[model samples]
Target: MTLDRSRWQPRTTTFIVLMAAANALLYHAPLFSFAADHLEVGSFSGILTLVTALVALFSSTALLLSLLALVSHRLLKPICMVLAITSSIAVYFVATYQVVLDRTMMGNVQNTNLAESLELFHPKLLVYLALLGLLPAGLLAGVRVEKSPRLRVAAMAASVLVLTVTWGWMASGTWGWIDKNAKRLGGLVMPWSYVMNTVRSAAPKLWQSDVQILLPEAAFTDDEKSVVLLVIGESARAQNFSLYGYERPTNPQLEKAGAEALQSTMASSTYTTASVRCILSHVDSSSEFSTRYEPLPSYLQRHGVDVIWRSKNTGEPPIQVQTYETARELARDCPGPERDYDEVVLTGLEERIRSSSSQKILVVLHQAGSHGPSYSTKYPIHFEVFRQVCESVELGTCSEEELYNAYDNTILYTDQILSRTIDVLKRIPAASPLLIYISDHGESLGEYGLYLHGAPWMIAPDVQKAVPFIVWMSEEFTERRNVHPAQLQAQTAHSQRDIFHTILGALSIQSEVYEEEYDIFNESFSNR
Candidate 1:
């Protein structure tokens, strides 16, 4: 069929040109520039370098193929549309992932609501709208010129012109954004920067340096022997088990053990890095720790008592407190036979407990707790406690029952890990004094359109943040280290800020840095 020449009008040409120009300008700003700024990665040199490299690759491909389409009438429009749309989507996903990393690192695992995330980069919204408008305009123009060879040629010419201009604008902005954020983005590589940003943004609260640990003078006495074990669970949201009043019986073992389980009712940050960092450090709700500085592990090691960090998650290693001291005292990280079991963590724990040369050792167990989209992987195969669980990730298509079953199944496995751990602790020759367990943070299971945990803090609630804290005190701990049950329960109301001091206090370690202002064992909880 002969091409229709009549459809190629000045108006059509203008529309194509404007659409392409608008799309390029809008998409690049947020995808590249805004991302750098939000991540505090400085300017164009910082965030755009990686994006520039990627866009350059894609742009070259677009230009080469557009040229090919330039020669063949059959290929031009399809290739151009494909390149433009796909590249735009790619930019969006990259920026979204960075935001996800930012929250995740901060111990938030819940998904950020679309509206809130969009607000953070509102300047880029115009670009997204512009591109959406262009898609239909581009298609209509191509169709109008289909029957006329002359008009087809004219439309193609206009389309390419628009592509060139739009592509240039996006490329240039990417470079400029990178240049602007160069300082902030300095030394931050992809994925790592994304990961750290997530952790940094999700930091809960940090206590000021003024907070002090009020310890009795000459606190050390051979007469008093105390042991405290702090088992830190990773990505463990508190709302998914019977122990936390989850509809399902995910914690039958813990329930049977009769441990005093308390579930907090607020949403904390959304990631292990931020959640644990905040919990382990003496940080309070008012002050945010400058993760860029102040490594917490060193602070713990400076005082007496042994500090051990055992990690199964491979994202970022815990911030180092003191390299030399930690190296000598740290528990070896055995992430399991595969990325799949909670059992691997309990392996060396018992040995470390019994063989400890020090009277007071702080043991940190980081579990692969209920990390979703792959819940089945978090447990031992033998447990198989729940069936019909979500075995795949075609999300939304999976039945609610299936997804929940899979999630609870992970919890079931977690219970086994806890049970076995308790049994081992009970067997520890009554030498150890106490075992305290708390999750790094909580998870969300399809609550408020939230599937995973890392939602933005301003929007996330207590369920996702309220973690489970349990005290497994032995007879020795009760006689020597225990406070009144009433006071201990009241201390549960204390923020995670006290975790650092409570551990030190339970061990009877004297450190000037420990603060009664935030310490759980402080006489404050006693209302004395």
Candidate 2:
């Protein structure tokens, strides 16, 4: 579509200048700050590096905005104004906060409930909007950008080529190899960071839509009354727990409650949804993303076993489980604020237990376990065993000791939640109950200057990959499944794949999909 360029008002050109100035100011300071703060450089080299980064960032931004201006022609002002405001706001906070905006964080943003998102907004955010967005947007209001269409097109093309070449040349002259590639870190440079992330997140959803999973019929051998619970922990690392001999009494509640911690178990990934999806499915860990999976809960439900998936966490990708409730849903159905406590999943537990008339029951609690930045919020006030905790979202701003203090408190709170869950199980009259606890992935806690999980597994520290897997069962459950306590203690190495067959073996579920070799309990029983 061709655009008419007939208006030649002086305000039009002035509006464009104001908009361009606003754009440069909004992003320029942060680009300089990020380079000065993060990159290592000598005085002579540092100035050159910072200059190059700023030039590349500004020229690329100008190139894109100029092209949008030329193409939209008449519509450019309104569209560009909106984009400018949005970009300014995004860049301001991300640059001010010093955090990377990536796809995983955007997935979290997409899935977060309004109540949770509201917690993020404060008076400071409004100030940012006024300074970054409103000021420029006000200048852009009455101006119409239409006139000299041919000249505008030629100028835009020339600017794009010149800016593209200039950015490339500036990027090439950095002193070291790391500095040469430092421009890639420009992805963290605000509006573009989020814009790129949004594209990446959307691409995966489109690609994965065609995944089709077909499963054979499943069956169960019944008679023994039983209940099985799988607790999916969040951001917990095995090395921190006393159960793994960390020196800190992080597992005091679990130890006192006599929960058996499986000392050596590593998660396949370091992100929540990815790890949980793998553990709860039949897909191999190596090809978890590539292969389609029959949802574990749905598969169990079809076999006449009851299954319920309840969570207090957010950002779950679509799963096949029909019996699913997030913390928001649980809070609405029951009574409570939607806080980070994992106990929300236990709301109306007695009724749920009674409602399931089936002999076999599986209830999964997806916990907001030890999730970070504001780790103190994850637990009640009493759980603060470690002193002077780091309570800010900017984890890098805090001392390492303070960060650990806040983190350990969450683990302590998790131990409390787990203990309470076991107490809930003990109340049932006829059911032999069992609880299996494992974290979806571990956390970084300021290791190697990395503050969170989701680093590619190969380069990630063991603290990010190693997870705690624990189990507790009533005496009846132990006897029924032939679980020799001695044998469980002796078993050290295990994969997440062990969960499927272990649950089946425990329930005496007769199915072709069940692998006896994966069931640790089956080995002890076979020898007996």
**lDDT, each prediction:** 0.54, 0.71
Error of 1 at 29 (Å): 18
TM-scores of the candidates in the order shown: 0.59, 0.80
Task: Give per-residue lDDT, candidate 1, residue 496.
Answer: 60
Task: For residues 479-520, write the lDDT of model 1, one tens digit per residue.
Answer: 665554555665435456667667766766565656766555
For model 2, how does the per-residue alpha-carbon lDDT over 45-112 read when each residue is reduced to its tens digit? 67677666555565556555566656655776776667667776676545434335566555555655
Q: How many Å off is the CA of 52 in candidate 1? A: 30
Clashes of 1: 60
> What 10-residue stretch in candidate 2 is worst by lDDT?
4-13
